[model samples]
Target chain A: MSAAETTPQRIAGRGAAPQRSLWHVILVRPETMTLVLLVLAVILASQLSPFFLDISYILRSFTLSAEFAIVALVLTMVIIAGEIDLSPAANMALSTCLFAWAQASGVPMPIAIAIGLVAGLAMGALNAFMVIGLQLPSIIVTIGTLTLYRGLAQIIAGDKSIRMPEWFIGIDKVLVFGVPATVAIFVVVSLVLGLILAGTIFGRQIYQIGTNEVAARYAGIRTRRIKLILFLLMGLAAAIAGMLTASRLGSVRYDLGLGGELQMVLMAMLGGTYIFGGRGTILGTFLAAWLLVVVSTGMTVANLLPAIQLTVLGVLLIVAIIATNLIYSRAQR
Target chain B: MNALGRILARRETGIAVMIVLFALAVSLYKPQFLTLNSLRVILLLTPLVMIAAMGQMLVLVARHVDLSIGSMLGLSAMLTGMMFRDLPEIPWGLGFAVSIGIGTLLGLVNGALVTFFRLPSIIVTLGTLNLYRGLTFIVSNARQVDRQFIPADLKGMSQTSPLLGIPWIIFMAFAVALLTYWFAMHTRVGRQIFALGSNPIAAPLRGVKVTQVTLLVFAISGALSGLAGIMYASRWGFVNPSNTGFGFEFQVIAAVVIGGVSINGGVGSVLGVMLGVLLMGCVAAALPLLGIPGTAQSAIYGAVILVALLIDRSVRRQGIARFKAARA
Candidate 1:
């Protein structure tokens, strides 16, 4: 048995024994595959439009994708630890509206920002309370909260635009290394997140809790605390994104991040995160964010109709999700 | 089965009482609300929504939610809208066939995702919701059908009285409701849905083709939404892309859930959904006709949904507590 185990299990094919290791068998990863495809997409996009290679356009697009990338990063933790906050888009919208309104009411910029962030924190706490307290599924609870928050945001905006001053709008536009500050934030945040997810015990605990809550509990992990922390992280990320967006536009609209939930979910899923929880990475999501922004920018720079761009996103999201499911299922086998 | 029967018996008895009370209350306010004209209008509006509620209720019962319903309706309407505009010579029955065909296709998309992709139905439907709407946007592109081009034969049913001064729509609605309720109660897959919803893994282990049933439910839902779309367009005689059916999907979902369909899946009835839809429709038409402010009207719709859900939750809690007590 030991000899058989030590020797590689060779196939019955009539050929030289295939030199292989378990590592070789595990060589193919969906992420690597996606990486190759992304490179191809970039090459194709660059070929399609000369304007796509312009540093300014590239930076501008990355800045646009930054908010989603950052939020998806934080949301990855939430999904990893087994929960979700679909209300973040609505939360961001409401927070932005409130921040702008408060600013207009003569609140200082710093105070307005703090208050805006507090709103998200409060929402996250409320969500944690509802899900943990009521023992309701996160999906259903978040959906309810999504509507409720959006409704409240509408009431706050009241069919009006809430404007912020030029200073806030320009916060993310200032260049670092000739790239927009917003894009810089997304890259730095993703890098930091990658290290933490790969290197930290807290990160391991998150995966533990996500993989099996009961087992995690038995292993002496505080699953509830982990979840609450993840929720707050999501909220904070959403708030930051909202602020950047508000600043970028020089104003806060009622729909500051309207329909962002759709984009965020698509990006996260396309990154190959398991929807049921316990598997994902900031790196994968960052790649997805890059691919999406590049695709969108590439289409626009090429003067392709925006409709087809969306259709591409739609098809890509579906194919990515279906492929991820198949790959994960096969991997399990 | 026993729990289901009990729930149904309780919901039906409760709804029957509430309907009578609501009707009496309305009559007291305006005697005209009791008149044949108003009743006929109510009936006229009932069938399409009833058919839709049945389909929506099925998805809910199977533990999957389809938010793409409005988009489904739009696709069907657009298909027939052009038909009505350019192919007016075509029989109205042909329009129905086309609508159902379109609805089924839309449902298949939703079903395949929910079943084969092994993803959450909400996520799939949510993606498709925008996808469908986006397609509608691309296709409609501010297009409007002329009222003059609308087929009169289809419009006639919206206004015509068939029996007891009741419009044909109500009978059709009631018939659809009856047919679905009977199917859910008697069919093999019907019971399988309940089993799946209650405990999906257990049901599949016990030999239920959960995927097939789930896909079929979603398809039926899509078909029903399509039918609703056609009726809505035929009644209104034009399709306004911006305003037409834009927010109606939310209303349908809210109504279905509040009518005692469990938000968690596996415990809703067609009867409950029908009553919920009617109650919502009444509130929508009556409150405005009574001259309620438009903004307040929208808020009231959300509020009513919340209130209904609260009531349902409270009742469920009580039932569960009682069940535990009995078990003890």
Candidate 2:
């Protein structure tokens, strides 16, 4: 085997590659870098506030980002498949708006919820059709759809916030075993996604497709169909997240998750996902989600303005991607 | 007949035809839409997008995208507005220079990150987009530049017309477009940009200075966005940190794509981009006349982008097929 191939195998601990050492495994892995940063952020965050170490306070803050964390899990999969969907944040808005509008118009709650989920599925189908069926670049196509979806949400909601039924509000307040329901959902979903991505044939094909679609196609993988399914899954996840958001906020507006695409992408990038595709893990994203919550929560507690928070998030995105790319490039060598 | 067919064969002709059809449809519903005053509204509304799209066209042609133009516009506009607010004695024209200079610096930052780190332009600009916007808020202390602080002369650019009753901002936009046309068509460095976009790998082999061209395109994009930000103050008489250039990139990108600028790079023209901006402007102007609310305006812009992508894709496929047949 080539030196590069042997290194990964040796790191997996299945074989002995003489040149491989513990330091190489520790320093070269993108996840290792993420773990280091995550720890630093936690320590720094705890120092910023006396309450930061309290389990209840952390759980409450995690609820604020739980929906996005859930969606980020699917986004990690999509990026690993070599395609991206920038429209999920918009998807959440439109789908939730549809749900709220339907219920406000006197539709039954369950049916309205169904309508919302279906709208999300349809949105995903449209994205799949454009990116896979029409053979267009996912990046540009999603940017277009992102605008389109958000605009539609505005048209539907029209600067008005529709209220949900009283019983439906505050999923964040609903706790199971002292954890918010949304956070529980996030954990469960992350576990499932992480397992699938790491241990399944379907998941392996996704990596193969992302690494090189043409090669994957030649290898008998149904690249187009797999991408379409991933897109659909992304849509479903965004829809579910949107519903959770509405429950947390008690209302739905066109701007429900306004500017959320930035945070979602930030989560994936921070989790050490390779921007160019073919590499990333759900576990990394899971840790990154908590890291981001701690960092932002710490900033909030320190009385920093939202503008500064925005600047910090932007800087973090750049630094994270740069560090991950460097790690990956070095590993390749 | 032959000349007509050749003219029709160009991608710009398709956009022109769409514009005509759209205008006719709107005018038929409301004949007042065809009036000269209404045309002026469309023309007036187009200058900012027109200017920004020229820069975007070049960047897109260079095979890189710049999402930070909107934030660049916001930051530069905020800076200029602050200057006029605090240093009232400074000549208003200096605002243009300052804005453009800051914009160039920001663009160079983007270029440095993309080239030096070999990072993707989209992600870099996305980061800078927020970064620059946040800086704008920080520097301005979240305060908007009020109308009273803006100089009368600066605002007069949008109000006063030296020719054909058109605003000076429109003239400035056209002038920039003209300069861009000359650069893209006549200059060696300009041609090198097209080469870099068409094939980055082959560009180095052909002696194209890939780094220089990429940096230049990004810088130009920033400078133009800066110009647009200044024009925003002229048009609106105020500059709000968050509102000045919000969603501006989408409008410019929609216009550039509609203008037949291939997203894959190496193709576009000043004339096509101009027509694209005009088409978007006409639609925007027609919306209010047709009783369509402002909320639907963005959706239309998004739909227009997708349709343009479809048209661009088909046209490219046909061209490829024709080239193969000729080769065969």
Candidate 3:
């Protein structure tokens, strides 16, 4: 209706240019808007610090955001369903510990990988069960699991680093052009998951679940089963992220992901996932991940500390959330 | 037989049972736990938490949460520490009052955003939590204020025992508790809070100024946390960004939930929270006496809260069922 109203005013030449906006609003999402800002920052950073754009420096930094982005894609889906799995960071941390511990104890590599994946699935089931069966709030339940899973990591490793042996170190090495194999895996996972969220029937059901669970139930969407599956997907993503991060670092520590869960949520939220749920896209999330890394690199060029970058991120999160809501409301009208 | 009587009876009876059972268990384990000296510690511990939890309970009963409390507490601590170091000659009472004044403003922002933005309180605080924590960290970066920095006279007031051998801080906490209880039970503002919590849409339609009520409750939450902050500095004698009142936010929240304050908002008591905080205080104090390994009381705390939540969820369901049955 406003678009119709605006056509006349534009015709009357109230504003400059033919206000026929062909730009995709999805690309203009808050997280993506920040991505633009991030790119600007990257250019600025590279000009300031020669190290900012070095292949090795970019390789190291981008990979962390890459793994985070992969998991954020799945968590974006979970939050869209009006639930979240904060346990993922802790889940990955714990699984990484388990995998390394098993391998150190002379367990075969493939079996260790299987253990990591199963551990994640079981952890996911714990979350799914409480949220579905017990009807507990997902936020509180995840918080509990966050503590529980991290505590398990501490017990498994007990303040000691479990180093990857020669064989595992080989896995950590870059598969293509010394570009870090983990980053490649992250890119693939993000792509596949992005497709699942955007194109599939099951993906539509996820939107249905988040927008309104009762309505979905009334529409015979089998909300419960879909939720369980979505959570399992989130768990699997965390497991993958855990494997990648643990592989890259070549060591597992309990405190590895101490506060990363909240950071991921912030990243996902900054990436344009609506906190209230159901109104976000995975590609937007992926773009937002790159935005965070760019901003981090940008800060380094400006000689800003992580402290300032983090504070700016917090402020940016608040602004982006508020601005996104304002824009979404305006666009709707 | 009546509805009101049954709830009051249930809550009070529950508290009484817990108090007696806990007292018995403590006496059996340590024997000295029953002494007035140890009793003083338990009594001293409950009221301050109860004071902070009262405002938390109020906001919670109204169906909003403020994770900014930990941040607010951190802010309050830094401000208090600075005041002591900067103005060592200032009167104790005035220093504390100014500390509280700063806290009220901090909480007011949280209340305003949640009420006006139509944003979920959870996300608002999730951001503000980082924002506030970051602010505190920046303000007090890698700096420590020692006991010598605080005016000795002002510090003495916190430790001074005046109420029949109880610490003045303890008496002060109790007084605040009673005032809150009275304010909640006997005032029009309190009734409006109840009305809003039961049904927000209806309450506004019935002429309750919800924004005003929400702001007032948040201001109260901040003031209490400010008071608790000063008390904390005196007890601990130092503060750091790493571990200063770090887990207190969630613990206070968990305490309220365990005490049967509905997380959905509405229906809790200052008195109930008093018992709940005591329960937390006892467990913290008792674990070592019970010879529990390590200082990680959080594991025990998590287990206790989970069990309490399970029981509380069941009891709430039972109450709802009874209400439906009685209405039918």
Candidate 4:
């Protein structure tokens, strides 16, 4: 397999090609479709509530899911590399549980944070070992680890919520340049990851790997090492996200970020990331995170029940994947 | 080569030995651990999972998974419970048909999505998992069917044994296993499922109807899950919107995988699934005897899955290496 095989190709007319036009390129791209949807969502949200149009209100609300958004950027890269890490949310819970547990046990704050990061890295390394080293499928392995990590968190936290010190609480309240600290961090992380994915040789290699891992390896891409590093990055990102969540909520519990894997995957899928791998963009995911936050906030403000919201999210996930696959397959034809 | 052969030979025997050793270890720690009463406890605890694992085994053998089974179970159970709560005059026997019918419909939706829309089963089922759960909540009005509303006959199924100390429910579960074994081993379509999993590209060329087989497997899985749902109401005497059948998929998948049902598909056995369920049952029964916290049980199950995966991978590796050596 080659990059061309994985890359979406537009099925132009069989006869002589028509004149090139900006609209044609823009309309055919999934990213453009995402942008249109995002704008439509915002407009619909503002219509639902006059309060939704406020910039500061949206930014503040973005903080609620900013940690998930931040990690999703890294996840975009992982998905583009032909692998997935479903255990990240569980990683967040366990790492945050460890961090909080360490602090509660008289470990210094900085040391506790270090322990959390290290623990997360170790978890990722374990995943990398099983998936890359042992050559097992990532889906089942991560599902297994997802259970293990969440279970470990439950054992450590034991149904109790551990409160953070007053000074350590409310990262979202700590605004950076009048933006919530969490949102600012999310923006910064997205920009940096976006550039790396768009403009770096290493990033190109990720696509090549996803397009064809065996061919990439034969091409001397050091596929396993790259995947290992990507897994480690995933863990590190999840650790940071967990801490941000801890700071935002001002407490940690075993069930912290429970069922968040769904939201994270939803963001990626909605962003036009091919589920089979080899194509996606951070910009798409970045817009999608806000789109989701807006849509969810709109529903909440409109007094929709969380159960209904869950149904909406599930529907959105299926619809998004179907649309993305359709667009990609059409492009290939 | 011999090492590979030995591992292959021990797949079923391996689980049996593990179960025996686990029981022995627990018995040594507490002399009362091994007893007829304990056997009954394990047997009673296992029937629901044993039934569901049969469905999951077939799905896995077709190289797809059904994560929504838990939610399907919940939805079907809640529907069945609603019937019992609203219509006390009706006989409780029809609850099985109602639940199974609801489950099969849900399963057909999943199959249609995967087969017609051509979506990945994992993602499709993941979406449906939450979708069905939400539907359950909506239909039940977020309320639980109370113990009293559950028909007395339903609850009695757990207590009343048809023969000796074995309840009818246990017999029902084994009957499902027996039927699945016969279908998968003796039937042409069932064998085609294996052929499809082993080489999807070749399967269609060889005249297999991929869509129909896939639909049948998913429908069976859904129907069995539905059966498990009604049995849940029978055993527990109540059904909650949120709690019934929650995380049920993990338990069944764990049993199926541990039973030497390959996650990669195309291979599994009814005997292996039964032994897997029994092994899990033994562990669950021994936990209280060993003074381990109930909190540790979920973690143990998680760890068990990972450990099983490692063992499965190593065995496959040896098998592959032996194949390569033979070719060379």
Model 2, span B1-328: residue lDDT tens: 5998999899998889999999999999999999999999999999999999999999999999999999999999999999999999999999999999988889888988888888888888989989998999999999999999999999999999998889899999999999999999899999998999989888877888777888899999999999998999999999998899999999999999999999899999999999999999999999999999999987888898899899989999999999999999
- Candidate 4 on B1-328: residue-level lDDT in tens? 5987877686898889889899988888898878899999999999999999999999999999998999999999999999999998889999999999999999999998899988888889989998999899889989999999999989999889889979989999999999999999999998998998878778887888999999999999999999999999999999999989987887888888999888888888899999999999999888888887676766777788888888788778888998999999
CAPRI grade of model 3:
acceptable
Query: Where in model 2 is the C-alpha error above 4 Å?
Result: A1-19
Model 1 chain A weakest lDDT span, ten residues long: A6-15
Residues A243-314 of candidate 1: C-alpha lDDT, one tens digit per residue: 888888787777678778878887787777777788877777878888788888887877765555555666
Clash count per candidate: 3, 0, 1, 1
Docking quality category of candidate 1 according to DockQ thresholds: acceptable
Of 1 and 4, the candidate ranking higher by lDDT: 4
Q: What is the lDDT, from 0 to 100, of the residue B151 in candidate 2?
A: 96
Q: RMSD in Å for candidate 2, one decimal?
A: 3.4
Q: Give lDDT tens digits, candidate 3, residues B1-328.
A: 8987787667645865786798788789789777777777777666556767877888887878766677777778777887777877777667678768777887887788777776667677767766766776777764766778766665665677765776667777778889988998899999888888879878887888888998888888888887777766766666566466675666677677667676666688877777777777776666667776433454444545555556667777888999999999
Question: Predictions ranked by TM-score, top down?
Answer: 2, 4, 3, 1
Q: Of the pair 2 and 4, which is ahead by lDDT?
A: 2
Supply candidate 2's per-residue lDDT for B248.
93
Candidate 1, superposed: residue stretches over 4 Å from native: A1-27, B1-49, B163-170, B241-243, B282-320
* DockQ score, prediction 2: 0.55
For candidate 1, write residues B1-328 as lDDT tens digits. 5977787658655765666687778778766776766655555655666778788888888888887888788778877777877877788768878888898999999999888878788778777876776676677665766677667777776767677766566667788888888888899988888888888767877888887998889999998888888877767877665555666666776677767788667898877778877776666556545665444443454455555555666777898999999999
All candidates' TM-scores? 0.87, 0.97, 0.88, 0.96
Q: Pick the candidate with the highest lDDT.
A: 2
Q: DockQ score of candidate 3?
A: 0.33
